[model samples]
Target: MVRTLRTSRASRALRTSCAARPEYDSAPTGGRKSARRRTGTAVGTVLALIAASAAWVVGAAPSADALPNGLALTPPMGWNSWNKFGCNITEQKVESVADYLVSSGLAASGYAYVDIDDCWMAGSRDAAGRLVPDPVKFPDGISGTAAYVHAKGLKLGIYESAGTKTCAGYPGSLGHEQTDANSFASWGVDLLKYDNCNDDGTSAQRRDTTMRDALANNSSGRAILFSLCEWGVDNVWTWGAGVGNMWRTTGDINDSYGSLLSIFHANVKLAQYAGPGGWNDPDMLEVGNGGMSFTEDRSEFSLWAEMAAPLITGNDLPNSSAATASILGNRDVVAVDQDALGKQGVQVSAAGGLDVLAKPLAGGDVSVALFNENSGAATISTTASAVGLPASSSGYSLDNLWSHVKTTTSGAISATVPGHGTVLFRVSTGSATSTGTTHALVGASSGRCLDAYDNETTPGTKIEIWDCNGGANQKVTLTAAGELRLYGGTQCLDATGAATTAGTKVELWNCNGGTNQQWRPNADGTVTGVQSGLCLDVTGGDQPAGNVNGTQLELWNCNGGANQQWRLS
Candidate 1:
């Protein structure tokens, strides 16, 4: 069976179960308040600021106010020790990160909660069956580390598996839910990352039980943020809201562009469960964490803002350089993380080499990020008047969040980006009009895809459609080789490319001097079909031949095959 999304509303039936250096009243979440929330059970409504002492079952479905308190975690920024240090995590490390949080000014910038990931525990529990910190690693013990973090003005977080063993094969919570929760709460723990790797894919009983037990242990009214790391079991998002403040919808992330992009694309639409406290976590940010580049790191950070994900950093804080610190210190982008609405943006459309991700911000403004995740350099032109804004966002005009630059984009927001790059913008509108189409398409120019300098690939290459880019597919560059080159990159049109005859396909093939891949557009709207000696044929001559998604194209006996024809409308 296809893997069903475990984050559906139904997944909240599992009951799983921080902080404040502030005189601040809780922030109202969601867009302009609709109605006052009547609190009773897990009321996740906008007005239900604090939760009462009613216990809940893990994944136990709750009312609209299901999110426990104001901790659904909009800006769950903290330091983690997995990606960089791996099993080298020690109490000293956690405590030092807490120190960095306070001293490096990260805590003041809204970065709190220092967490210890896998391997902080000894190989086995004690005779009393309680988890023990490795004497070598912690020296003092789990409680000592939590106390140290608290002294440093940061809350402490710990990790464990819901299964028989933690990811590192250390002692886990498994059947000892009550013991683990009691021990965690007793140790002054503030956050729990209950991973689900070693556990058998058995039933949801374990899920419900462990989560319930944790809630039972948090009787101190100290809201426990349960982070279910079940990797999309039973459409986890649906039931996840009832379980914890945040749950990871996907698996652990690597510090690579491909991995980051894949995870972001796979997870969207669950942003509704996110607010001030409840979050849809896309694992931890692998930014500035050694695995990916600066470009990849920027994109990863940008995506977290778009997804409204928990901004837990899994890198060594003490070792971060100036560049890394700057990437993490973008207060404006982080504001998107704290955008109160907590709505995760999604990939609305794709063309050329650009992609558009939109998240609704607090107040009336909407945050939109236009990212270039392609290889070569690229650009895509989009009219701001067409992007849900009225007159380029009121007083300050258009604001670019990532760069913190402000400009009047009353017409269009055209951006030039390096390959594997991005540009993020927050379009604020008090009374702006939503415009054009649901998703705007980028111009398909002529260029082999290209980097900053020139075409990265061989000239006269095939023309491929990347995320909406203006490189070459948008800009046609007729080549001297009698073949057309997408001005900047590789990818030529394939003439009668498919093996099949009738329901054959047409795509970007090689520019091997083939007729099937040649075409010329006239001064008028008509594009002369040079390849296959026929205009782009709309095989079977059907308009709106979609919904049955596998439709193919063939070079029809051209009676000016309408199906093969497209006029960039």
Candidate 2:
């Protein structure tokens, strides 16, 4: 079949990424605009594409129940081409970097993925209407490049778009998902970074899901890690794990400190969405990009590592400075990123321009980040209890993640953090209360108890406040996984249907590890729904305490209200 030129209708959908390193597109202003890369001019970019492109057969792809082969159990570490070379990538360039990753000691450090972004393909498909690599750039094609990279003991990653044309205006995988997936798998590709560009009117979710299914269903034995690059549209973080190994949760990151910080600040709140087999990618790393000082670069690396992000280096490895090398090789820091527990950190407290972020690691240790975003150095303090240590612990043993020094604190740990810098700590504490021990969730306002309606154990039974009776129903256990369990751990205090509204019903449901079933007990005598960010509250505050019995419980704004406070006693 001969190739042909056709005019794509003007896409009402938005186009977005980086432009000449300028402020072409800023950090995410809204969900859609900030999530896209620079769109190539549609006309000249694709002079000719195969007129017989594969049909968009959604049914022929993999089953929704099927998953990509088991890989990226932890966030993947590696180097990428788009951030540094963009469309200037050549097979030799990738091969050279792959060699550097091995010789430079990055491979042993677990930085092994070498990915090529868009523009690797020729303008026209091959005789079979399959995508082809540029002969000039790779006389041997993608399979050759993959073999070269694999020979270096490193994995290979390829890029494509869910749209008709990629950001660079090359043919994408929209209708040819199965063909591209099979081609990539046949090439022995280990990763797929699928972007959303020139998508026309197709929804990001559907497009991304299509590619995910295709990759998962590929007949090749290779387990390709699917990275959905939708720029966090539709809050991809909440459901990205069902489709891909990792999903970009922010706009593209540049070399500047402002860009780094903007992306970081925007993404940190979505930490709960990340875990083993799934991660929130804050785009690629700019560690050796020369836009910011070594301090800022180190801070950037620390924050991303603390959040358990994929450590995909976007710097020129061969020309990296000593500082960049040091930042990348900090084994202790990388350990935090690759923790076995796979829990992403969260911002626990922020005051006076100082923010405290905490990630609970495996083995009862908590990673703490005292981040100073203010102009001058500030003394930041947070107690072990403040960071969600169990009530049984008196203090924690702290280790400096960067300096590798150990210390212990009986109460609060205070440090003077430089402006735009962070003091990272790994705090280990003793075991928490046993799972079977019952605790009364005493309300601050009414001084009453959080009681299940009529002591009912059935699902959907409403929750209400009652007098402190100390009965089996009034006594609930806080499981180590953050679930508040009633009925001897059989039923959980669930937010009805996972609702986040203030007046939504709170009920007893079968114990499941869903996010809505998890609750976070804070140092401020308040309990918040880990998934919804709403405080557990007693319905009416005006009623006198003695008469408050039987008052309905609801999720309300965290206003330090007596009604919204609870003590696990």
Candidate 3:
């Protein structure tokens, strides 16, 4: 069954205990009706009390419009309790997991956060209206557990809903956001997995932003990573970077190969939304879970790393097998996920149940994954040039991340991947030419070359589309500094005013190596500006018949149209 349809054991117990309370009747229901049913005068009274508290001083609160807390510089690598222990979590179990994370070498390998996922709280709030840890389940309280985790040099994460009740029927932080944020900050929580269950009809953005502001304004002066668990509704990725460190792009993941593959497909396309402080979370890792085969588990880990998804393992680490440990502790594979460049892998090609993905790493290395999704083994192949490595006569070095075998490839990056398996390689382009490679930037739709208007060498000359006549003005060189140089390396293609908005003009300027002049040639045959993230376009090229010689060039949204596509010929 899908994870969303499954209820935790603690939720059932909470339902039985709260049967007499009308407000608790809406624990399972979400949206508008549930909001009206659960939030009565008591919620408003509690908010009023919180607002009147000296802690709510207006000037101290961080701006709600501020950028996300700079916590997860890379996609978070950790373990969460929901997928395995669920609502059965206890202080001892959490402490034990922290122990295993350190002792099993996973911590040293990069897994850090030991996250508690729901049901650790009592059925009702205390008389003071503060959340209380269940005395039986968490004998030492959340603060004690966090202290234990912190002692082990790790961080602790806690889960709560944005509505009146959590998915597992625990009291959520919806209207009680500031109170709960203060409680979490006091407990020394390092991360907050804010779930979307049992939410009021309020817009997800507003509710999430409310809690984000609450967390920021907490008096403890702590920086907690905010993880939005809205399950991809409302295009969370589009605004998640400004609100949270990582955002879920799909529903909860189960321990099955089909679930893994579906989530991978759902998340791989969101590469542009992922970066240093924010990530596209495809739910937690099920590596040690029994539903998938060894090959499938390895494939899931490899793909998640390639896509730069948070490596939050959701399994019993203490009792995990040696193979599971090896897979989870593979330093080479983990390095790709934690690469400093923080570029998520993009699908280079996919067809016939075979796929190739490429991620650019810091220092000119690219991580390539050859995946076979069918029921049998197959050979998947792509060239170094196809994966965005600069062309070179000396060839590239391919380091098989999983096998730890090194080999040299003149250009081809092919692998015979088994069914439901992935062959991941780190392709080093150290031997590739670094000074520059001159080529004609030919527009795929217009069949014209990128040219300076009137062959002008003056700065601020408009770049335009013209017939490919092999002239010096049309010859562009991609350099090691990421600049698109023209006019015999004296002039560079630049986005006007370093603007990031669409329709920014492309102009020729002296080569001073500004970010506006930096261009990245994506595998999809589109060139994007480093500062703007906009594609080089032949004006009106979306309409096949509109583009002509002397048509102006501009930076526009990447619509995957033929007009935005280009060839470095």
Which candidate tops TM-score?
Answer: 3
Least accurate stretch of 10 residues (summed lDDT) in model 3?
Answer: 18-27
Candidate 3 global TM-score: 0.66
For model 3, residues 112-163, the per-residue Cα lDDT tens digits are 9999887899999999999999999999999999999999999999988887
Off by over 4 Å in 2: 1-68, 390-395, 430-569
Q: Flag regions of model 3 displaced more than 4 Å.
A: 1-66, 430-569
Q: How much lDDT does candidate 2 score?
A: 0.71
Error of 3 at 471 (Å): 64
Q: State each model's CA lDDT, in order.
A: 0.55, 0.71, 0.76
Off by over 4 Å in 1: 1-65, 204-209, 219-221, 390-396, 429-569
Q: Return the TM-score for each candidate structure.
A: 0.63, 0.65, 0.66
lDDT score, candidate 3, position 130: 98
lDDT per residue for candidate 2 within 276-386, as digits (tens), equals: 777899988887676765456767888898888999988777655433555676566677787777778898888776889888877677888888776576788988888
Each prediction's RMSD to truth: 18.7, 23.6, 23.7
| Candidate 1, 276-382: lDDT as tens digits | 54567787777656666555677788888788788888766665543345456556667777666556776665686488777766566767777787877577556
lDDT of model number 3: 0.76
lDDT ranking, best first: 3, 2, 1
